[model samples]
Target: MRFLVTGTAGFIGFHLAQRLLREGHQVVGIDNFSTYYDPQLKEDRNTILETYPAFSVERLSLENAPALNAAWKRHQPDVVVHLAAQAGVRYSIEHPQAYISSNIVGTFNVLEAARQHGVKHLLAASTSSAYGANLEMPFRETDKAVHPMTLYAATKSATELMAHSYAHLFGVPTTFFRFFTVYGPWGRPDMALFKFANAMLKDDPIEVYGEGRMSRDFTYVDDLVEAITRLVLVIPSERPPVEGDTLSPVAPFRLVNIGGGKPSPLMDYIEELEKALGKPAIKTFLPMQDGDVPNTTASPALLQRLTGYKPETPIGVGVPAFVDWFRQRYDL
Candidate 1:
């Protein structure tokens, strides 16, 4: 499949592109290379992708609608995987506009491109944060995701609705997957695992929000990429005019959960990282800040029903692998 994947420089995007390229798929990737963390990390990731003969990289942001539209028109891809977003729950509190621009508006651009290009199947990234204030264990696609606690989640939720609307109106087959806490090699710097490792390495106190009471289903990067790759073949069927589980009644669109179905406690995750790095972190437990959830777990039943797989990698094995990569890459 000739694919146009956004956020090719991102952690998940890089991994996904690599897997597809290794499998001999022609891939066209794009990224803005923003300083949200460090453009150098994105550049390094892109460099790795450049080694692939079937991979082509373009430097651009989703905000550039004209440029993105042209790329879509040029590639006329078989599939579209939209992963570019201004990602950070805490950062959203200060810079809500960034989330709106990148997640909401950026998603609008992708939907438009998918619709205009008449793409076969469209799979975009959503978040577990969309299940805000629900207090539901094992979040399902059928659960109501109306009350988003943070702007970041709100924008992502809005993108889901926007995609659904496009599917309903234009008959575009769209699959939106809610991702849990994703971590492993080439992870974002703001994520807990990365920060915890860096803090522990430098002998600094890693801030433990909610007094270390939170838990997360930290899906490994490879697991995530596999789930995504599998879904490329499972596009939503034609709308059948149904009523439950967000199965689009008007178009071929569905929302699926891609995550480790089991939840791991925050302290447990930290302990695993400590063992991986051979350094215990200085504790700084604090109250739960705004826009933070105590836990997030996914109900991968739908994913299994469709793709015959669920993310099952444990932190014990995954964290050490990531630590090894970090050590080798950064000389930690």
Candidate 2:
């Protein structure tokens, strides 16, 4: 299979592209290497991918439609995975325009490219944050996600709507997967696991938000990649819908939650990190910031029904793997 995956330099994209390359598939990666976190880390990931003969990359942003279309025309990929976006809830509070441009305009371009190129299947990344203010435990894909708390969540939800419209009008098959709190090696710096590990290593206090009462369905990167890999073959159609499926009634589009349906407490996650790092973290309990949800848990019924798999990596194994990678990468 030939795959064109955006944000190949990002954490999940890197892992997904690497998995595809290992399976002997040709992958054309697209990344602008934005300094959202550390460009050096992005470069390191790209450098590793460059060694694979079946992998190639284009240095461009998804907001650039001309360049993106050019890449699509050049590669003529069989599948498209859109993952690039301006991520981070707290960051969106200060820089709202960035979210609009990257998440909105960027995803718009990807949808256009996929529509024009007649790709077989299109897979894009959404977030669990879309289930904002619903107060619904174990969010399902069919639940009402009308109230988004932040600009970031709003943009992601908008992406889902736009993709649905395209799938309806243009006959493009699309699958939008809402991710839980994903954590693992090569994770984003803005994520909780990375922040806690970094702060603990430096002997700094880790900020415990929501007054230490938050919980999340933390999915490991490898598990996410596996689910996505299997889902690439489960393209949506007008056939009968599976039980608990979120398939659109009018279009060949679907929404699936890629999680384990297991919500772990925030304090328990920190404890796992402490155990992995062999040190206790100095904790600073604080109120939950605006646009922050107290808890999020995904119902993985649809994902399992479609892919026959679920994200099952527990924190005990995942946290230690990340800690080991952090130590070797930074020599701490």
Candidate 3:
């Protein structure tokens, strides 16, 4: 099958595209190489993907509707996985326009392209942050995600609603999966794992937010990608298949939470990193910043029910793997 994957140079997108190519699927990737992080990292990822015979890429932002439309016309992809967005909750606080343009406007273009191009399945990325301020443990797909703590989560929540409208109106099959704190090799620098690993390697003090009280369902990158690949084939339908199935009665749309089903404390995660690096980090505990939730956990029951798969990697295994990659990548 031919797949059009946005943000192909990004952390999750790159891994997903590479996996698809390994399975003998044709992949058309698009990435603007935004300066959100270092563009060199994105370029490096694209370099490896370029070596694949079945992989091709376009350099453009999702906000460019005309360009995105043209690419859709050219590729006519069988599946559209929209993953591009201005990520980072704290970053969104400083630059709200970035979130509006990239998340809202960019996603709108993707939805229109998918609708017009007649793609079979459209899987877009959402976040556990969407469960903003909800005190519920093991957040379910059916839980109300009304109170988004940050502009970033609000934009993502908006995308989910927008996707539902398009799917209902155009009879498009769509899956909006909310991801918990995902981390692994080739991860984003802004993420805690990356920052902590780098700081520890340099013997610098790592900032501990929420006084080491915050918790997250840290999903492994490979596990998240595997769940997505499986969901590619498990398209939703209007008719419900099982109990508590999130299949929309009005449209072929659903929401699934992808994570390890385990929440780890921030301090514990840092300790795991320290173990991986075989070094101690200068710890500086601080208060939680604005637009930040105290904890995020996912109930993988829905994902497992649909795909018979669940994210099983623990921090002990995943953190060390990332440290190893970090050392090799930076020659630390």
Candidate 4:
């Protein structure tokens, strides 16, 4: 299968591209290499993908609709996986415009390109944050994601609606998967695992948000990528499907949750990191900021019904693997 994947340099995108290439699929990728964290890390990830003969990378941003469409038109992919976005919860607070441009406008461009190209399947990334302001445990795809606490989440949810509209009107098969806390090796530096590892290794302070009173699903990158890889082939054909409790019924689209199914406490995650690095972190307590959810748990029943798989990486095991990579990468 031929695939056009956005954000190939990103955490999940890089892994997904590599896996597709390893499985002998042709992939065309796009990334602006923005310094959301470190451009070097993005470049390093790109290097791995460029080694494959079936892979090609185009340095571009989704904000530029013409350029983005040109890339998509030239690639002529059978399936389109839109993973690129300005991803961060706290950062969304200070830079709300970034979310609007990348998450909203960028997604609009992807959907437009996919719609125009008549792609068979269109898969895009959404985040657990979309289940904002809801105190529901194990958030299901059928749950109402109308209340987004952050601009980032709102944009993603809007993207879902946007995609559904296209699917309903134009007969495009679209799948939106709301991802939980994704962590693993070759991960983004801005995430908790990477930042905490750096701080703990250098004896710096690791700020505990809400004094470590949060819980996250913490889906590992490998498992998340697997779910995505499998989803690329399982396109939703039925329009307005029925889901338990919640789901869209007018469009040929459904939002599925990709997670490990367990919400581990923030303190327990920190402890796992400590054990992995063999160093206790210097902690500083901080109050919860705006646009922050205290806990998130994913209900993967619909995802399993579609893909027959779910993320199951425990932090205890994933932490050590990541710490080892951090030690090898930075010589910590």
| Model 4 CA deviation exceeding 4 Å by range | 238-248
lDDT by residue (tens digit), candidate 3, 1-332? 99999999999999999999999999999999999998899999999999999999999999999999999999889999999999999999899999999999999999999888798999999999899899979899889889999999999999999999999999889999999999999999998899988888788899999898999899999999999999999888633566678888889998999987789998889989989899998999899999888998899998999899999999999999998899999998
From the highest lDDT down, the ranking of the candidates is 2, 3, 1, 4
What is the Cα-based lDDT of residue 131 in candidate 3?
A: 93
Per-prediction TM-score to the true structure, in the order listed: 0.97, 0.99, 0.99, 0.96
Better lDDT candidate (1, 2): 2
How does candidate 2 score on lDDT?
0.93
The whole-model lDDT of each prediction reads 0.89, 0.93, 0.93, 0.87
Best of the two (3, 4) by TM-score: 3
Candidate 2 on 163-225: residue-level lDDT in tens? Answer: 999999999999999999888999998888889999998999999999999998999999999
For candidate 3, the per-residue lDDT at 242 reads 68
Off by over 4 Å in 2: none
Model 4: lowest-lDDT 10 consecutive positions: 238-247
Instruction: Using lDDT, give the best candidate's number.
Output: 2
Candidate 2's TM-score reads: 0.99
Task: Report the Cα lDDT for residue 111, model 2.
Answer: 93
Residue 56, model 3: lDDT of 96
Model 1 misplaced stretches (Cα beyond 4 Å): 238-245
Q: State the lDDT at 270 in candidate 1.
A: 92
lDDT of 1 by residue, 1-332 (tens): 99989999999999999999999999999899999998899999999999998999778889899999888887778988989899999999999889888998888988988878799899999999999988868888898889999999999999999998999899899999999989999998888888888889999999999999999988999999999999898878743433335677677889989986899999999999999888789999999999998889898888887777999999999999999998998986
